[model samples]
Target chain A: MPQPEYDVVIIGAGPAGSTTARFTAAAGLRTLLVDKRQELGAPIQCSGAISRHALEDVGIVPDDEFIHEAIYGFAIYDQTGERHVHDYRSLKPDEYGSGPGRKPLGYVVDRRRFDRYLLTQAERAGADTWLKTEGRGYTPTDDGGCTVHLRRYNQDIDVRARLLVGADGLQSQVGKWAGLQTHIKITELAGCLQFIVDRVETEGLLEIVTGHEWAPGGYAWVFPKGHGYAEIGLGVIATMTDKPARWHLDKFMTQSFFRERFADCRILEVQGGGVPLAAPLRTQYADNLILVGDAARHVNPITGGGLHTAVAGGKIAAGFITGHLEDGMPLRDGALRAYQDVWLDALGDKMWKLYGIKTDIFHNMNIRERDEQLYATMADYFSPTSEFKKI
Target chain B: MSKQQPVLFNIGWNACINCGACVAICPQEAGFVSPFDTIAVDRPCDIACLLCEQICPVDTITHVPAPAPATQNGAGVR
Candidate 1:
């Protein structure tokens, strides 16, 4: 096998890896993007609901078919079963629909299609792409580069790179190999189970219901993906007091509340995974290595949305790597620390505050009080005129 | 009742939801829900004000005051 040297070697072809590859390639870096799976975006694990601002920030505009629905606003249901609906259109006429008149909100995306679109974009940007290439391990070199070991078709191949990016998901082997703290406390980890069911008539609205009875420290989401397909799932924090997430998901899916709504639906895919609900790693970089996306624990503490953060982090990682390469600086602790600082400045404090609030509400508040306060806060946050601004 | 210095308790700010239940149920008017949207503990009037702690729905409130030193025989134990 011919040995190849790349300026940047990115693991996992998910959103983060692809985005990193795109940015680095565009910056004239020799980038190699690899994924373990034979296909990209298969066996989905996300609800794929992202804020409108996140998409525009990353410069990704979904085509009509890929966009399931344009969300009007949000409806939050509290533990006491009271619902509060906030329509952005009614509150802000200037931003209520698609185009100039469309609401400046968000869209529910078809995750699989979206991921594929991003990977395609990376390829077009000149990234050397390899599918079904599983990252085995890496050994840091004396000069501050890395020898990335990968397995393709059961054959081990070694590739060298000046920098390594681990965009792997929650259980990231890359993070471990790079000597970063990757273990998530049971309480901070959310075990989620979901099903993509077809033929379910769901409004173009996103629903988030929170309570111990429903999910216990987490929440259930109903995201419509058009064409009668919807991503429905529940996330439960794996705290000492809470049962396993699978049990809660099974109970919710079979319960009367969801059974009636999904009785006639066909199961398109059964997906399950764990998400780390913590602040981004205090140290996301070291010599010749950096982490992004779930590997860096960038998922939102409040909503558990990670796609946007992952993409953003990926772009930052690319920028940092480009600067390092152009300057011929050693990919040492100090060099990579710049990447960590930039990301923390971008979204760190917000995540920490949200984490604190999540713990407080779940542990101390009663159902009634918790519900009321949560609804009020969300209303204020999502309202067009509310001062609670988005980060 | 002799006036005593208020004992301050730092209720986990994260766990508080700004509910006035604790304030309403305090017999000594020692507990007030602050407008900053947090729970405050008044130690002066609270001869161990466990009411707010007990009524807390999430059990996030904890008494962090040190236990009084025990006396051995007729002497005070340090």
Candidate 2:
């Protein structure tokens, strides 16, 4: 029997895969997007904090319905309790530079709604959606395409495509199968646990606390989602420690500081996840394959924000794949290399540089010193009127 | 003519976080942490200057300058 065929078979229907499917299908390519999840957005692991620049980059306009809060700026505190508040709204253009407009820099988003919106967009663009289907593996065909093996609820099937894209999260089996190095160093991985609490009064400011007392080699964040709801979470660098992430989170959440602050709130949902604090992969593509989003390691090392990056990567990948298909070129190493070079040129170099600075800031200082520096620097770093602003 | 001695430095690989800060800021690409459990050092002769140590998160590295030459009598060394 002839194998099932598609112009593109994308794995893991998260932001990356969905965006790629939307763009490629709109370009008139036959696309099939698959995910293992029963629903579009469930089991949320992210803190859902994205930059204002990110939304604009992905062409996503935040409305009152989708956004949780409109954040003006961030407040940083150190181990010794020294606080520094940086208001992005009050900065002067001479001190910072251009692009420091009066708009909110970003907002905390509802992950479920945001993801579902992206998927809906993809569906509207004419891509076949395959929920509850898990990609098992793939074998390269002699005709410069690939035959993907998949299993759905104990039933096996196959799909053939000229190109494959992997947008799965941290534990991406697709990345591993594609022979990309997905090994995360223990210390570079931040084990995080978060809880969304309702009836929590927040001042529309994102709070970040740095110190060993809160989380070693990591920080705790309280992101206000507005309407008396907030997402509170902490992350710790996973070294050789045998303790789970929840243990550290429990230790911090039950402390006098957190208890006193959030005593009146009620827990709505508990989420735990791991984020990779590293630079984007040096080579995100191979023969007949491309990796996007978390699978491509496009996460920000400082804030762990990946939604925007994933969308951007997906758009770039779709453009490349569309061009390749148009030219009737086989998805060979040279063609994929072009895709890698263009994307990296656009985003990878800057991210790598930022990752370097983030590593230096976190690794060289003790908890107390880090907190102090953050408090001292945040004003200048984020203030529109400060010379160091531009992050 | 006097003889020259080579200096050495020991980097504790186990404590590295693979953050790449050292690689980015290092004037000499002497310090690099790979995801594959390998720490690459380009020139050992550059050990006299220990900039990477200052930026290291865990301080797992120690730079050892060359030891003074021994006396001919093998008594107390300089």
Candidate 3:
């Protein structure tokens, strides 16, 4: 039997794909999400930290099932271990008014479960999902729709879609298949290594450490999970490191601060990955294609945070998609370019300014000067929530 | 330069997620890793940097040793 044609087919079931699928499917478009893994969120690759407002903006209400811990605020430490804290409650009263859920500034969640939950939302919204499926390429139909070639488990088949949304992450094959330039320059890539440490005491404070002795172009972080669990990792700018990222991470793990904290801890998980520092793509749409999330280079150039952007961008894409599909616009019509314009208008300026400032101020300065300047303008980093840009 | 062997076979087929860390951390001046293409390392360019192997997040890369001269098995077995 042949698979039913879909109005919209999204590749990758991550936050962006799931959110877009939810919105599109809920709006009555036949949507399907395809993932390479049998499970939705295996091989977890995120730091699992997100702001409360960001989560709320994405329509995720924190639940114990996936929400690990509440983060009141986070702190930054210089090489000498002198700390500067960003207390959300005290610092951003105007932005985040007193409320039941607004007290805790953010959350540390089980990213794997959170990702899966997002998939469930999409499924509940009437979208279908194919697990262990991979998209090799697509051939455009005469109607401007595409016959997407997919390999599901051991079988090959062609699925049809009028519009294709690529949320396939930093190494998005969908973007490449659509003939989009998604290559990240080496100098703009940040290498990260993390360990889930158990039996570590966390004071409910998320720690961001800055120093040349550790991560030169980037920073080290300790995001709490609970009473005795947290994720400890450091990201190194490629231009500053000569050896494997693990070598520097290992040194960081041995530091007196980390050593004392994790002395009684055992490593429960390991995660390594890279975050792109490029500004949002100049063009995020082509033909009948739309790219969202990390695939569109929506990650923060300095903090590397992208969850909010992924969710918001997906929502924005879904809005445009809904209009096109509902308006009965043919696949060949130029309406799809609206997605590109809307997204660029929504995110292009913020991304460009952030990337420029990050490269000029953070990347160009000495570690000491960087820390000094960051401390001087404590609100500059987190108050406006500059790193966590929304769509 | 000698023809370099395929050091990491099927590097991005399944487990590799194309994080771009390998490219950023490659010690070789000429080494390149991309999900779009397969030529990650080459003769004189790599110089056996092996940094890609060490830094791969999923550890999907492996090196295959070059074959020795094919001799009479009985004499070479020792």
Candidate 4:
């Protein structure tokens, strides 16, 4: 029997792959989305916070089923108890919403549900999906296509595709197979760990804590998850400290302020993964292959956030590939250069600037010093006046 | 007495959450032992760059020198 084939084979069913598959499949391309996990979003790795603008840009309405809490502002805390608050409600009506009521700045979601919802959207748009399917490797074929070798249920399956996409998160092997530079340096990688806890009081504000004492080379966060629950987590540069992220988190929780506040809180769940804090990959595509989401290191360097970029990058990939396919154009690096150019103009430019600021502010610092200037710089970067805030 | 030609690391599977940080940054792709048990560093391609060791959040990977190489007689090898 002949092996099944598709116009595009997307490895990973996360937001990036699903969003890309949704667009490509909807555009009448034969698209397939696969994930190694039996379930779409099990063993969640994200903090699940996404900006309202990001969701709007991706055309995904914030449904109540996945939205855990509505965030209106941010409260940034320095090492020495200094607090700075930015409230989105204070934004001019034109800057936020045209409606009578004040709109939320962002939402903290249940990531598992949010991811599942995205995959469901792609499936509804006519993308084929396979669970518990792993992409072991792939080889470029003649006529500018590739054959993806997947393992499902101890069975080997090969599917040929004109285009292959890597949306496989931080541990993506697709980019490696395509010979794209996907390796992250130790200093550029942030090891993150989060705990779901209840009885922690947080209003509508996402609390951000910055200090070498707390997170070393990264930062910590307290995001409300509604119903009096919250996710308190932190990311640390693995090379900056001899200890692991869990140790830093444990020590952070024992701080006098957190100790008293979280004394009665119950630890409900734990999640952890690595986030690439490096600048976006210089090249995100090769011949007949493209990478989206964390696979392309679309994450924010300073904030270690990628949900927004993942969605946006996926959309761009879908548009670029669909337009090329429709034109009967060859899927070569020269043609795919447009994807890189457009993405840089839209989002990558800001990320590049943030990456510079991140390296300057976070590396080789005095961990004990209360650097108010550093905090001010961070505040400015995220402030309404900053160009990065536009993303 | 026996000689050791290669060094291999043993992964503490109990402590591993299979987050794949080791696999992501490994230059030689030496961290993955299998599709199901991907946490083990069973590959002989290890250059001892120690990036995987530093990147592991749980410190579950430990460098354990492989047992001595077999002698000419090969009777002492376990």
lDDT for position A342 in model 1: 75
Worst 10 residues of 3 chain A by lDDT: A382-391
Q: Which structure is stronger by DockQ: 1 or 2?
A: 2
- The digit string of per-residue lDDT tens for model 1 on A300-352 reads 77777888888877887888789879999878766778788877777666777
Rank candidates by DockQ, best first.
Answer: 4, 3, 2, 1
Candidate 4 yields a Cα-based lDDT of 0.81
Summarize candidate 2's per-residue lDDT along A102-134 as a digit string, tens digits. Answer: 567678888778777777778889998888888
**Backbone clashes in model 3, listed as residue pairs:** none
The most accurate candidate by lDDT is 4
What's the CA error at residue A373 for candidate 2, in Å?
A: 4.5
- List RMSD in Å for every model shown: 14.5, 12.4, 5.7, 3.1
Model 4's CAPRI class? Answer: medium
Ranking by lDDT: 4, 3, 1, 2
- Each candidate's iRMS in angstroms? 18.5, 12.0, 6.1, 2.2
Worst 10 residues of 2 chain B by lDDT: B29-38
| Better candidate number, 2 or 4, judged by lDDT | 4
Q: Tens digit of lDDT per residue, candidate 4, span A1-391?
A: 7999999999999999999999999999999999988776667778998999898898888899789989887888887658787877665554544256667889998888898999999999999999888888888787788898999887999999998898988877787776777778888888888889988999788888887888878888899988889999988888789998888888888883567887888899887778888999998888878889998999988778889989999998899889988888877756777778888888899899889887776653665543555577667766678667755
**Residue A33 CA error for candidate 3 (Å)?**
0.8
lDDT winner between candidates 1 and 4: 4
lDDT of 3 at A10: 93
Clash pairs, model 4 backbone: none
Check candidate 2 and list the clashing pairs.
A52-A105, A52-A106, A91-A385, A363-B57
Tell me which residue pairs clash in candidate 1: A95-A103, A96-A103, A97-A102, A97-A103, A98-A102, A360-B15, A363-B58, A364-B58, B6-B44, B7-B43
How do the residues B1-78 of candidate 3 rate in per-residue lDDT, one tens digit apiece?
Answer: 536532443364475554555654454333254433323633223245455555564556556543333477644322
